[model samples]
Target: MALLSHDAGGKPVRAASGANATLYCNESTAGLSMLHKELAQLDERVQRLIAAYRQARLERKRALQERDRLLALNAELKRRIEGVVERIRLLESDQAQ
Candidate 1:
């Protein structure tokens, strides 16, 4: 059931659900033709915010991928350096003998 009544001036009043609640119209409509315009503006703002959030999520994923790649490269370089050091140590031992 809709909770509504008309004031003496013929303006619609929100009743029942609200305590002597009065507006030009329903709470959702908020009265008049202004409601449509306001709803459109609010929708546009929400869409823009959602798009920004999606772009940020994509950038974060790409950054994580790059970090993993660099870490792998560092590990490979460490292995190669350690191998070279071991060879140098063996050469010194042979020379000393």
Candidate 2:
């Protein structure tokens, strides 16, 4: 007897060609059910990975904005310090005279 049967969809049909046809059908059904469960698990994992990628991209953008703000603040502080130094030098020269 043939150990396997084919359905119209080409998936293994749950039947045997001979006396043990019932047992074959049960086994085939169980296998297909397990395959469906595994596929569901894989799908959930893929969705979680996609969510994590989006979160990482958002964090990177925030970091870049913070870096730009700090750079602007540093430039402003440097300009103020240079102005103060020039004033101190002028004051010292006037007192010396």
Highest-lDDT candidate:
2
| Cα displacement (Å) at residue 12, model 1 | 8.2
Candidate 1, which ten residues in sequence have the lowest lDDT sum?
17-26
TM-score for model 1? 0.64
C-alpha RMSD of candidate 2: 3.8
Q: Can you tell me which runs of candidate 1 are displaced by over 4 Å?
A: 1-31
Report the lDDT tens digits of candidate 2 across residue range 1-97.
5536676698864554665786777787798789799999999999999999999999999999999999999999999999999999999999999
Q: Each model's TM-score?
A: 0.64, 0.76
- Residue 3 lDDT in model 2? 38
Tens digit of lDDT per residue, candidate 1, span 24-60?
3345445535868888999999999999999999999
Please give the lDDT score for candidate 1: 0.78
